[model samples]
Target: MNTGEKDWDKKGWKDVPIAGLITEPGTARRYKTGEWRTHRPVWDPEKCINCLLCWIYCPDSAIQVKDGKVVGIDLEHCKGCGICAHECPSKVRAINMVLESEAEAEDGEKVKEETMREGEEGEKERKEERKGEGGNEK
Candidate 1:
């Protein structure tokens, strides 16, 4: 008898099925060290079926459910892999992945540009006031 045969004593499956996919025999796959997250998951409660697959499949524990609604990522702990987006099985797809690049952040380059513009406007106004005062003194 083959030792690999399934034992009936084990619960559930009688035997493990063979996998169809196989890695290259002598190739080493390299992975990125740091957490990878280009996008975050956004949920729409109206469309959510509350199946909880997103919460269960998340390796990072990023998905949360509160008050019967689904929420994604703590940000402090979430490393977005789009796993939640992929796992969500609703026909309408309630969850969406949003990019979190520097351009998307609150204090990003666009905000800096707006602040600089405001500062320049203020400086111009101050210069005009000074010119008007000098003319009054003349």
Candidate 2:
């Protein structure tokens, strides 16, 4: 097939690298844009109906999925565009767009709660071990 060739450099344009240009496939993954987000989407696992609309509509592909269900939101690449929350069904209301600071506070609370629960469990286990040791000795 004879194809007409046009001059790509007719305007003296050089093939120089530019920021945010997709010169190579899958290059966008290297650049994390999550820092640019002002708000973050918080997913409520109990309220989610596995609609997958958020996964489909998310521009950042941050919705994590497993076994045909949404597992969580990947904050590493999530741009906090709120598209996932917006795409979520109104009745489900599983995804909520919260301020970054508020989300941080919520996350910190969760971590604290988890630590407390672990401490309690550890204490209970130690008490049980002590009782077993003391009963056998006596």
Candidate 3:
């Protein structure tokens, strides 16, 4: 119903709300559909020119902006359509579509590194516990 500064009452059909009804508002914000995304748009800040072409082309409105500049992707609502990456200008190519697994793999590596560090710390604790009668809790 609230079309954001747009006078949609004079307009017809174009950009109309679902079922042409305005009973409930802000439904999109209530639910995050990005979990369905299989691939995600990754941005390179160094290469980005803040053109906002991606923002214009994105169907889910996942592109986030700040101060009239492109900032990042809102993964919570992104459906991994890759239109942002596809629409990115060829010369700039600031956006890249990467497999979700690959992106998570990079995060997994960081988690592995952190777990290893924690294991080292726990090793010292285990040794101290072994000195007790429990011997590391059986």
Candidate 4:
């Protein structure tokens, strides 16, 4: 049976039988519902202690645990419910709920900061190298 969305649109509700139709259990896995979320949970690995509390509290089973540790979040099935962030027991707060727009901006800021720091460190090292070479000639 072609249960695809295109087929349903062409068939229309009148032609398609609605009653007594039951899809297989867990069929909802085929759909990515995360797109409907307005807020997303951001994980901080440095603050996480592998307590697994988030995994236990997640309603959608979105928290991915592997080898007795949380590997990452399965965003495709996640509804951005923020349960994982709320359940994180770390004092540093391993998980945080941020607005999607703000999250992007935060990521950009972090990248820029890291780039600037690296550039400064590289410039200092170059200056030191030049000083060392000039001093050797004296």
Please provide, for model 2 over 12-38, each residue's C-alpha lDDT reduced to its tens digit, 9 standing for 90 to 100: 325545542445443334344555767
What is every candidate's alpha-carbon RMSD to the true fold?
Answer: 26.8, 20.5, 20.8, 20.3
Select the stronger candidate by lDDT from 2 and 4. Answer: 2
Candidate 1 lDDT tens digits, 74-128: 4433566777788899586877777766424845677546545644454354455
- Give a tens-digit lDDT track for model 3, residues 1-112: 2244634445466555566565554343534466677897888989999989998999876776767787667766678999989989999999998898788787677844
Residue ranges of candidate 1 with Cα displaced over 4 Å: 1-36, 102-138
Ranking by lDDT: 3, 2, 4, 1
TM-score of each: 0.44, 0.58, 0.59, 0.58
Best by lDDT: 3
Candidate 3 Cα deviation (angstroms), residue 115: 21
Deviation (Å) of 77 in candidate 3: 0.6
Task: Tell me the tens digit of each residue's lDDT in model 4 across 15-56.
Answer: 644673533443344445656667888888888899999999
Q: Answer with 1 or 2, whichever has the higher TM-score.
A: 2
- Deviation in Å, model 3, residue 93 alpha carbon: 0.9
Model 2 lDDT, full chain set? 0.68
lDDT of each: 0.54, 0.68, 0.69, 0.67
> Over all chains combined, what TM-score does candidate 3 have?
0.59
Candidate 2: clashing pairs of residues: none
